[model samples]
Target: MTGPDKDEAVERAELLLALRKRGIRDRLVMRAFEQVPRERFVEPVFRNLAWNDQALPVDCGQTISQPTVLALMTTALELEGTHTVLEIGTGTGYYAAILGHIAGHVVTLERFRTLAEAAARRIGSLGLANVEVFLADGRLGYRARAPFDRIVLGAAVEEVPSALFDQLAPNGILVAPVGPPEGTQALMRYRRGPEGLEQRELGLVRFVPMLSGVAAVL
Candidate 1:
């Protein structure tokens, strides 16, 4: 292999090792992390640091989530191969791609059309046919495809939106970061059971605020 290719392989190996050290234990989640090349989803300027465990700026003043956080959130979902997932934020399409690798289908909503379109193109280039990127208000969830077996919100909100709960199927799991926009958030997992919505605190995290309405940008 060429020098750059060899270097990237080494970087990727180190990334996986870091993730494993940081408590990423699920074999399927680990495999998804390895198979999906993060460098492909990041902006070209930030591609060199793609394997590093850090959040990088994307368009629309948004940030792609750190690798460890992404893996932790995905692992928390406890995804099955037959599940359909709704992803609230499609930033750079990285997390959605991971879901696409593990789930039957992924419907990811991005508030900004530009981000949505760019993410869609990137996901398409990777031939992840099960993932769909849509420009919409994530706070409302995607009603047309309601009753998702799994849902993940890439942004932070003070409280879980009732609309999102309505979209979840029975026994469905939704994982998200919950807190005020400017403060540290808790990574929460909510499961819809016959008894009602059961909540669990996974850990502490920070993410961009979950905004209302779609962006006017094209």
Candidate 2:
């Protein structure tokens, strides 16, 4: 930790240790979290806090989800190497990077064009060719890439959008927080079945409300 480079390395090591201590033991997920430098996904003003296990403010008034939350959601998806994953609410593109590590392909949607562009550049810099960034409303879900094996919404939606549910392949899984925009929300997982969608509420969590429509400024 004497020089900037050394310090950054030590910080990343400690962050990984913290994640391990928190029971994030899945080798693939842990490796993905460690390999993707959280600092690169955060603004320079908040770079020092990137290693902290908390949400960091990102562009468009959104927050890059806390590491624990990200792990939980990603784990819930149960992504297989060949599965195609769709991520709503791209935010800082951090989640997409992690998904790319686990899934065969990732299609992420963002409402803010500026945030989407920045995320695209960062993902490109990392040489993640599997992640396709879209500057569009996530609520609509990417129809062209329908029947996703796993769908993850980074923001909290008031209710599960029927459109998104329809896009899931049979037996596919979707994870998102559902409830009122202002109050507490429950992270729920839905698995498509022949009978219908089977839901299992996981836990209580807070997230920025998933907005409708695109941001004018982007």
Candidate 3:
């Protein structure tokens, strides 16, 4: 506990406090936030800002989501140790890395090859064996790993894609932002019930729009 180690610890504490003030009380989500090192997920140039309550840029124009948003969304999922999670956006794999500590397995998708490859490397370096990164259109969902216990979309969409709904296991939970790409989106949580899908509105948030098809350009 010296030099950068001490500084990072302090920053992490402050970040957690901020999350608490924002009303995120889920113990498991807080523990995951405290455990994952967000600095490792951002570009080296922006590492200094990693602990700040704001999104920071990564490669391929993607930004590592603000810790507050991540914490809130994770809390909304009410994850369990046995749950298998699906993450739609894998920017820097930070969220996936956090989920790795909570969920049994995390399967994350990144449309950009560079982001997906780089995220895989970072997650590997952390030795998170339960997390897997894929380069593909997140909208399609992963049928091979169908019926996820929990699914979260990192980017904003006009509505939750039908494909994602199909992939959710019975009684599964899902969280996403739903609204027009240019306007503020409502953060929503959905649960598949015996009769139909039950929805709850969490809050408003702005995120990069969800795009279809795998990215061709860098």
TM-score of 3: 0.95
Taking all chains together, the TM-score of candidate 2 against the true structure is 0.94
Better of 1 and 2 by TM-score: 1
Residue-level lDDT for 180 in candidate 2? 79
State the C-alpha lDDT per candidate: 0.92, 0.88, 0.91
Worst 10 residues of 1 by lDDT: 1-10
Displacement of the residue 96 alpha carbon in candidate 2, Å: 0.5
In order of appearance, the predictions have TM-scores of: 0.96, 0.94, 0.95
- Per-residue lDDT of model 2, residues 1-218, tens digit only: 22344577777777778777867788898889888988899989888777778898988899999898888888788889999999999888999999998899999999998899899999999999999999888888889988899999988888888889989999999999998777778999999999999999988988989999998584
- 1-218 in candidate 3: lDDT tens per residue? 21344587788898999999999998889999998888888888877778888988777777788899888899989899999999999988999999999999999999998888889999999999999999889999999999999999999999888999999999999999999988789999999999999999999998989988898568
RMSD of candidates 1 onward, in order: 2.3, 2.1, 2.5
